[model samples]
Target chain A: MITFDDVVKVYPGGSTAVDHLSLELPTGKTTVFVGPSGCGKTTSLRMINRMINPTSGRILIDGQDVAGQDDALLRRKIGYVIQHAGLFPHRTVLDNVATVPMLLGKSRKEARTAALGLLERVGLSAEFASRYPAQLSGGQQQRVGVARALAADPPVMLMDEPFSAVDPVVREGLHREFLRLQKDLGKTIAMVTHDIDEAIKLGDVVVILRQGGKLAQIGTPQELLDHPADEFVAEFVGRDRGLRSLSFDTAAGLPVRPLTADLLLDEAGRPVSWGDGEPTGGTFTVEDSLRLVTDLAITSPVGIAVRVDANGKADGLVPHHDLVDHLAERRAAK
Target chain B: MNLSYLFDAAHWSLTADGSIPQLILSHVWYVVLALIIGTIIALPVGLYIGHTGRGSFLAINAGNAGRSLPTLGLLMLMVTLLGLGLTPVLIALTVLVIPPILTSAYAGMRTLDHRVVDAARGMGMRPWQVLFKVELPMALPVMMSGFRSAALQVVATATVAAAVGLNGLGRLLIDGLAVNDYSRVLAGAIVVAVLAVVLDLILALAQRWIVSPGLR
Candidate 1:
């Protein structure tokens, strides 16, 4: 766990980058710092690794005060991923991933051996091991960056807009892969991003800061969406928050109606078409969010959502009215 | 015009004082001496200034001053001060070789992406490790260009040393002009030009071998 107590960062010119801010980030969970430009989200993240020091407060990681520790030694034990990967252009992909371990005094052979496995774990093939960062695409380079950060297997990871440079499609793919990776590893993570949607998607606890580094809100994604602190936060979360609030609720145990003749399926029981024309709806699995289920139901011509099993076989459907009833029932139960 | 002198048996003779082989050896000796000493002095200063960014005014202005100073005048001044010998010639020639090397080293370090350096520091590399392992390797191509420029300047200018009574290819040009042996003068010019090209080519190959292929 990391704790910040009345942390204040004043630049040399007397600009208060971060005001007197105090917060606690839980261990083995992802915490995100998010805000608009000059909100000091990036500044606050840098303080954790001592890249930027708080002017008059204590930052403790686990139980020890980070201010008194050796900077290089402290940084080595904290995994850091930044924008554009900031990869060493001259090193091969494998060597870039091996940097931290080698610096920590691991033997060359052992570092390289571990690096190869890390590359694979990050979804890179053995062929990419010999290639340099320049030879890879932006998305591929970002993956290598994540691999390099994870190479040391540090308990606390710091990320500063790691996916901001990629295209939207690539960013979405990285987002999905990040969540999956987090589920398997469960390292304590602190990330900074300006995109509120990203904050909602990835953060276990989202820290929204106003300009000058004052905390505006701190809560789970659903809580932030359902109960914003004020007009500023409500406006910042955007208009789709009503739909976003449903993202936390799973589609499982929701009522599934029997399929009628209006729906069509192929021989393998996969969705083929609906009614007479093209299938307007997409498929959602039991494990998907209610937001996706609601979208699939609303977009279909027959007002029903197709439920697919792990094998892509259509098992049942949830009509639009049934979803509304389920939502109403959930609100009453809450 | 100098073909006959180059082919003449007397010039190639092992015992002749003004022989082509002897002249070439002396020329190469002066060039090598100047380069070694200049590199020793300039490389560390350049890299230190580049890495720290503290002495940028010195780095930016030194190359121009080095270029503008008259080599012949400096050699004459040193000869006047210390008398005519190889020492005066070498001191003058080494002065000519310092500017390009120092400037290029400074430029190389200054131009590298600061983000990359920040990343290296954040990854826990000590300051010296960042300099030698990261900055130096990345800056090699630029530093090498500077070194080559210095070498070429030294090779071409070492000819001036013969005017102060030093033995080198410059001896041919100085003595031949005095005696109207234009063939010997032409031969000296040809040999010096060829030497400059050959030396530069050797450095180019060395750079290719030393620079990281990933940078290319």
Candidate 2:
């Protein structure tokens, strides 16, 4: 757990990077700090590890004053990932990941073993252990960077726009990987990014900052989408955010389709023949949201419809009741 | 000019055909000894300059000054101080190796990536650990180049010992010059060049081993 009590940062040139920012980052959850450039999201995240010291007030990690501790020691207990990965070009991937562990007095063999395992956990093959950072692609390098951050298994992770340097496709890929890692590790993660959709997809809680490093808002994705604190946040999360609220809830139920031999063959399961009775017409063709379902119950149709695959077996069969209930639930969540 | 003369010279130095073989043996030994001693003196000084980033002005100026010092002037001065012997020649040769080495080592260290060093510090490394583990590995290739050039300079300069009547291949050249025998001068010069090239090749291989590819 980390708490910031009116922490402020004033640069030597009299620029205020963070202005009396106070927020609590719950432990075992992912909180993303996001805003435009110079908004101080990165600065705030760095303060948790004492990389950037606070000018006033206090930053407490698990209630201990982080400023009083040795900076190196404080950093060792807090995982940090930066853009470009900031990996030591001189060290191999394994040694790069093991840097903190080796410094903390772990034996070389022990550190290497831990690093190799973390690399594998982050989706890298053990063969990349001996290779250098230059050997990995952008996405692979990001994974190795993540692996290095988790090498010590710190209770909290601090990321400063780590995925922003990669291309959109790779950025999205890294976002999914980060989500999986966060789910599995359950570390108190504080990531700073500039992309709004990324904040929504990866953040368990999103923190939005305004131009002057002022706290604009902080809330769960659904809450922020449903109830933005101010116009700036609403605009930043974008007008489409309300539509995004649909995926927030846990999926209610799966539609039931007819049990047919051909569909079952494609599904690679046991086949059951369709009788005179329909499976309540809850199946819709894979292609009929805006076009022909060949048989689908949609906006204009009130009755249930059964859609079949090329093999004449049920693929997606939608019922009017299921469709109406699902839409209503989605709209209400929004 | 013939195999007999070579065999005769060899036997003379070791098995008593003449003192010529002994003269040649002593000369080779002198060159090798001076190189080892100079390397010991220079490597530490070079590494220190690279690490400390201080006194570089004096050190670099001193190296250029040493290189500019005429071997005859250096030898003549040393002869006055230490007397006409192997010690003066060795001192002069050692001073000759310093400039190339110190400059290159310092340049290499200064050029290493600050980001890598910052990352090292961020990972909890002490200042000394950062220099040795990070800076040194990055500096090795360039540092080795310095040593190679210095060693070559030493090999070429070692011949100056003959000007003071020391025994070396320089003695053969001196003897040949007195008798107007150009072949002996050519032969001695060829041998020195080949020796320098071979030593450079060895150091180049060592450079490969020292510079980890990833850092490059």
Highest lDDT: which candidate? 1
True contacts kept of 1: 0.68
Summing lDDT over every window of 10 consecutive residues in candidate 1 chain B, give the lowest-scoring window.
B1-10
Each model's TM-score? 0.94, 0.75
lDDT (CA) per prediction: 0.91, 0.76
Query: Pairing residues by index, what is the TM-score of model 2?
Result: 0.75
Docking class of 2: acceptable
DockQ result, candidate 1: 0.75
Per-prediction DockQ: 0.75, 0.42
Off by over 4 Å in 1: A261-280, A308-316, A331-334
lDDT of 1 by residue, B1-216 (tens): 547877788788877777888888989999999999988998898988998999999999999999999999999999999998999999999889989988999999988888778888888888888888788888888899999999999999999989998888899889889999998888888889999999999998998999888888
Score residue B71 of candidate 1 by CA lDDT.
99
